[model samples]
Target: MKNLSLTPFFILLCLSFVKAQEVDISGKWTGNSYFLGTQIFTEYELHQEGNSVIGFGTTKNGSDSSKFRLVGEIKGQKIFLKGVEYVYKVGKGCLSKAEFTYSNSGSMATINGRWKGTMELTTCPPGVAGRVDLFHKKELMVAEPVAQSGTSPQMLQSIHKDDFEGTELVNALADRKYYALIIAVEDYNSPDIQDLDNPAHDAVSLSKTLNEHYTFEKENTLLLHNPNRSEIITAFDELASKVKERDNLLIFYAGHGIWDERLQQGFWLPSDATLDSKAQWLSNSTIRDYVGGIDSKHTLLITDACFSGSIFKERAVFNNSKAILEMYKLPSRRAMTSGALKTVPDKSVFIQYLNKNLARNTHPLLSAEQLFQSFKVAVINNSPNGQVPQYGPIGQVGDEGGDFIFLKRGSR
Candidate 1:
């Protein structure tokens, strides 16, 4: 019958039916492993060399010296490994094992089986093979993908800054008038402070940077070094009065923050001030009240300090107090702090992210929400122990509208 061409046709069909599988397990993998129903987690990096795979795994205790190797062959859709060795450390003694497995899928394989092995003790004896399910995914080659386009012109103009020139981001956002007031307080005069050599800490250099990098409206930007409590109060009072007539306002503060349990409040310590004596000099409530009193439709308060929660309580009290009612009624306000209320300020990292991402535009562009999200991610990523940076709207005055851009086209 078709013997004249059957062999060639069959061979061609088989070759055409062979499909290549895609493997993508690369970089770092974080997952938990179970041994005898007890779970242990591993964050490992897998590297593939020809037909063999090798990598090191790190446990929660920060131990990562253990090495593992797997040698396998891929035949069509099946994979087979003859010798697989894993060596690791436990409480005292070291554990080592060699096993073999027949896998069904090369690209994606899961093995669920029992293993019986011998323990290395003085009287070594065979141990029961506990159940194990090892899951393997093919390694993938990865590269940083390009950012998507179609962003607004304002977003496109955002600058990128490291810690050294972070003030630029605030200026960039402020140029668009997205921010109403930008106040930076660096304590360069403190006797105990030693890092003042940084240009960021110098009042003159910082002010010059702000002036050259940003276009500020008259009386909108203030860069002070070790100002007294009275100066801060006066500035807030003046800024509040001016912003009460506008539709939106943005306020930013960077300095040392201290929490006093006795007063049940937090205070921003100026350069010349001490937490031991001036606990009441510049209370968080004072600033909150001033910002809360603005008649603007939207108000954003960004503070890089500790005990920021104390500001909300003060804002609430200020809204209900008679002091603010004489000049202006309270408006919607949103607040964000760089760290927990009792935590220390992450000044360099916080301001660096703000300056780098907020400044690329000549016009007001980024919404307060978007900027805060980016800042939060950056801070958390750079922080130790993966500590989460906390942020949320503080009081009832913040719910009128959700979107507030720091820069807008018109004068307030």
Candidate 2:
């Protein structure tokens, strides 16, 4: 997509800048290469003749491994290489090209670049490309797991990556387990308030979609239907206590919302909420507090309700085409609402498009902003009243401009 390159992401490596006739890219390079959203541990043994470069490297994912040859040149500050013909991977004839910018923090040289995966082979993962970040072998902080090299074939086909040990599961730039809090209130106790139809049904649909295709697991996802105010608060409290700083959190709500003009406040009506009393209603500010309190790398709140847009403080901005690695570096608190202080229908066009898009995405990493951009305009055009969906940073929620990344299953 756009002008960026794509790579099959099967093979690649790194190294130290040795002293030579030119800026040398020789020696053993060790680091991580992100391809197809999988973090492949790589090592390169390279030799340079003037500006020309030649190398062979190995990439390991979970227990899978493969070898390939590299050929490229030193072009000023960037090194360009093509990983062609997977020697051990069974694939023949393809170019997994990468352009890396060379930099040094003191004596520690680092190369980071984008990949362009050309499908010359029979099988090439299309859609989105990944990033490669390598440091000199000296910069490696921990040792990666190495199989007997015979397990590559079977490892490549396995859906689970539990074979990778230690904290590799929590690598911010790679794959990790995602936690979710799903709250949907369809049956309100108040006779004065009209009951809704899609909240519980939509929640079930979303929960299944997330657990089946994305990084979210059944154990990690908490679902509550027709929950009262206390139960809703308890769920947040439990997540705040359990979620670690490196993990990500997604909170989804499908229910009725009200905007009080006199008080300038927005509230989510719980199952126990009465029309005459505001005590049982959940305020947007309280939700904000919980969002900010959770020690997660990224927190994305998806609300399908009237006046749900009140959570947003200012418009969020991030280049969709930016490297996924770059986006994962910071922390974020963001929300995507059904509408901006406007009444939405019981049958939502918002959640409809959201589900369709999530299931259809083929890329390894899908960011929150990317997900919203895919369906916001469509929902507006298709809605009966032309409801405008809102997306932005949640106010005072410690948003450091990071985005919530949805890692599709089997990517790692």
Q: Output the worst ten-in-a-row residue range by lDDT, candidate 2.
A: 159-168
Candidate 2 residue-wise lDDT, 290-387, digit = tens: 99999988899999999888777754433445445446667889898889878999999999999989988866667888998899889999999989
Cα lDDT of model 1 by residue, 26-68, tens digit? 3344544344665545344444444454444443433433333
lDDT, residue 78, candidate 2: 79
Please provide TM-scores, in order, for all candidate models, with all chains considered together. 0.45, 0.62
Runs in model 1 with CA error above 4 Å? 1-179, 188-219, 309-331, 345-347, 361-364, 385-387, 396-403, 408-412
TM-score of model 1 relative to the true fold?
0.45
Evaluated at residue 264, the lDDT of candidate 2 is: 84
Q: Provide the lowest-lDDT 10-residue window in model 1.
A: 319-328
Q: Highest lDDT: give the candidate number.
A: 2
Prediction RMSDs, each to the true structure = 20.9, 16.7
